[model samples]
Target: MTFDRKDKDNVTLLNFYLQLLYPRMVEEKMLILLRQGRIGKWFSGIGQEAIAVGSTMAMKSEEYILPMHRNLGVFTSRNVPLTRLMAQWQGKLSGFTKGRDRSFHFGTQEHKIIGMISHLGPQMALADGIALGDLIASKEKATLVFTGEGATSEGDFHEAINVAAVWNLPVIFLIENNGYGLSTPVNEQYKCKNLVDRAIGYGIEGLQVDGNNILAVYDLIDSVATRMRENPRPVLIECLTFRMRGHEEASGTKYVPHELLEEWAKKDPILNFEQYLLEQDILTPDAVAEIKANLKMEIEQEVEAAFNEPEPLAKEEEELKDMYFPYTSDPVSPEGPVKELRYLDAISDGLRIAMQKHTNLVLMGQDIAEYGGAFKITEGFVQEFGKARVRNTPICESAIVGAGLGLSINGFKAVVEMQFADFVSCGFNQIVNNLAKTHYRWGEKADVVVRMPTGAGTGAGPFHSQSNEAWFTKTPGLKVVYPAFPADAKGLLLAAIEDPNPVMYFEHKYLYRSLTGPVPEGFYTMEIGKANVLRQGQQLCIITYGLGVHWALDYLDENPDISATLVDLRSLQPWDKETVSAAVKNTGRALILHEDTLSCGFGAELAAWISEHCFKYLDAPVMRCASSDTAIPMNKALEDGFLAKSRLKHTLNQLLAY
Candidate 1:
């Protein structure tokens, strides 16, 4: 099956032709199905079959191939059952995503194919993650990822390429320059003469090939991949091709010039390759006709079989089942001796302990290696564990987060640290769209823990200081953990890393050095979704988390006769509802407090829930005290005034009096 010219015979060439022909015919049948309302939509790759077929066939089966919507040949070349593919396109139960996603949006773990998200550039970074796994495992395998010329304009493209170049990961970034991105031409896409030229800027090798020529693609990819297995490094390859069809069947090609269509139609990949096969006597005219007939018949039968397949049943339990992997909370034993540590030290120790426990755990972030991160959390980590385990990524938040998802796909627990919580905005799409939606979309576990250094009491300004926990708490498949004490910080972090779902561990920057407590010496895991009752009282309940817990404790310490119960919610996403409700009912009054802004904060949800469930037991209305709906100020006095702590005593006294 190797593409060696000296070993090439009629059989090899015929097999190549069959590989190319199957997708072309599938595209043809799929179009008819789309027109006949059999399927939802189509992203036709009519004129660019050679790129997908040749590049995919060039790699080994164990090496992963990440393909976009137009790269259907990647699936077909891997011999994915046509019936299942058709069922996928038709949104049937037998599809890879079980009707959760349509078209080539689903990936098959068995085939070692990672599918693309709609944001085309993220998958490129995802490939870097898989290649990183290969590099770490010392596996001689190269990961091939496909992108369009249009996606090259995305920041993720540059970020992924730059990271791969720096790490020397075995990844082949294949850009199929199909003349147009949807309707925008190459002129609008970039200023470079060729897409491959950008590789020089990244300090990586670049190559260009006629995408229509199947042999050229096969030869170049095979040689590059072979070299990469020995000396692992990324290479950029731009395959010059044209899109014969519109972006999708719904979008007509009227925007395209007729002359251009005619020109590309003459150089159709299938026809040109067929002619080459005919001239070489590898495929006679009768053989070509017979191959097409058989492929068309096979495709039609598969499509018909797909039509007979059952549609996904609208069952509530089944629909909700795969949102997250099954998890049980392990009791915190704290088996060994304990030692006092700061919040920062507890986080450091927790990560250190997790790294020791899970050999496959990887830490990725900016300035985390030699510099020990912005907060000095991972100061000596690179020295303890090598650079491979403690990776210092570029300031490409989007790409690095996507890489975490990639690493998780290959059975690695990834802990991605956001230097500051506010910086997460840069990688929002990867977090919410890719990581959070992964398990729900295809039942794939994303064992990634994103450490967000959050909160603002030291005048770090609006950008550096933000308690944005509510942003991800609303996201379905993500877990949000925010601990106030040092011990809880370490325990919750350990639990977050072990969780099967993507967990957002928000570490309060204000608490890093200011807070200290007795943290267990050895490894231990605290139960997520549980609240800690720091104090018990009968008059009122103070519900809070992170720095707010400190604020509540300070208020309670000064006012001894207040008789208020303090509840610190360790996890926000699955906040301890039972404990909060019970405390509120017991006290007959409630006050929700947080460091985040007042409007639409996590406090709002807590207030609403308390009102709904604890209405009968309430002695007073549920009150919320939070920061003003404005950006965190830089001046110390203004910041103190802006925070909820400024008015916490007054608010608590008012609630107690009520």
Candidate 2:
């Protein structure tokens, strides 16, 4: 419904009350359920209901809102079915996340709500991405993201706001400053006088309002949203409110002062709004009582119905479903002549081809636009696709990664480039928790590719040079691809972009310019999870990927008499188990090699799998050749010693002899 300041008819007033009171009643009932051990937990938005209700009511239905756990009014204001919402809270199959998540933790696309992650700050960046999508589509839409004052202290908050301000995206950073983060007081949270003051640092419009006053919040947000749709820029709004209840019912308010509680109680948002309505002759005492009574009854019935609903059943096959969108590869055979390209050029060519093929594809990274990225992979991307598609982002890895996820949510294929593979550690949370789990938790496809320029050998030092693919290989729902040659680099990159799942494409820095091979002129894709056998033999099987593939090739080239099978496991996560097992069984010896540390490396998984599946055919124990458990040193001599190529050749010889 349209919010009008001058036209506050009885019907409008009553609807607003319903919007405000419904959540109040629902929260009260939820608390009761929590006390009765009916539901798992409740994050009560006891006194600060107006911020959610007012903000949600002010926005257009087409616009999006990312609400925190405490903003239950946003859900009620959007008119989400109470039965289904309660079912969600009860961990039933009818819930939005299919019982994969609880509370307001899951987002409903139909309601235009993007769910907030437990890591509260990342949603801010996600909001930036959604806004970016809207802006790109030329849709006059704005996105509102809610965060507490405590969450603003996170690096994601700064990164998201900075990115939003720089891009001038239509995003409203709503800070529900409810006095405390769990038990910590606001005085200790930040040194600034007001949360709104920090907005000036980002050069964005900042405002503060009496959050407990429903009318004031509604009027301000309504006006702000109207302006944002037209102007399309970031704004930071700090809602001054209080949390009357504990962080959760179980976390008691013993740490909160009795005096403070009394003070906030006097400023209860619902009571104050009711008083305002009464003075305006809009809602009488009886009317208020009647509205609350009806809402309470409605909430009770819905909660009861939800409680009676069947809980999510655990089936082995069902549990494994929806981790990723079904992907089928249609192999493209080159009809024309192929040309030789460097690994870096091949990746660049693949990116260009994908961008040309998919109009909705976007590339984001630090210095990717004008500076051509740290490694110059995207040197001419900005010129080719313009800044909108090939956007340069701040050095905030976490936020940009989250923004990529947000873009994917809005039907955009996003490819985020980490300047170096080691730098992925900064964006680790977004990759592993948000991107990796988005599909499994809520059946949302995270069609994003994170390009990681990896490996050591250039004396790039510990941080820049790392074979950290194992970190994500172990994480469920993430596809890790490490291509050894230039052709595989291009083909796998295109394949990764096309996959409807988050794919980590690892590019070895040493192979970028040093490796050259024939790549098809036109677009082509290599199958992920499938291994390519470079050589065929019968005495021994060598399973490896990335730099190890080259090492094994060189070793085999020198020792031609030693009959061996060299298998290039192009994909680590869904490694070519079929090919590796067959090769191992045929050869009767298995040797795994990698650039990562020997202990707990991806090779270890291969070794264990080979031992388990190929045990009967094994002529000797499965051997592994990898780096020692130490950081890659900057000194060339030290790095060479760390890689231990001599050890790799010796290990292969030992396995073949056995």
* Number of clashing pairs per prediction, in order: 0, 0
Off by over 4 Å in 1: 1-7
Position 80, candidate 2: lDDT: 92
What's the C-alpha lDDT at position 65 in model 2? 95
lDDT for model 1, please.
0.91
- TM for every model, in the order presented, reads 0.98, 0.98
lDDT of 1 by residue, 249-303 (tens): 8887888999999998888878877777787778788987887898888888988
Candidate 1 lDDT at 347 equals 97
Q: Rate the local accuracy (lDDT) of all candidates.
A: 0.91, 0.89
Off by over 4 Å in 2: 1-5
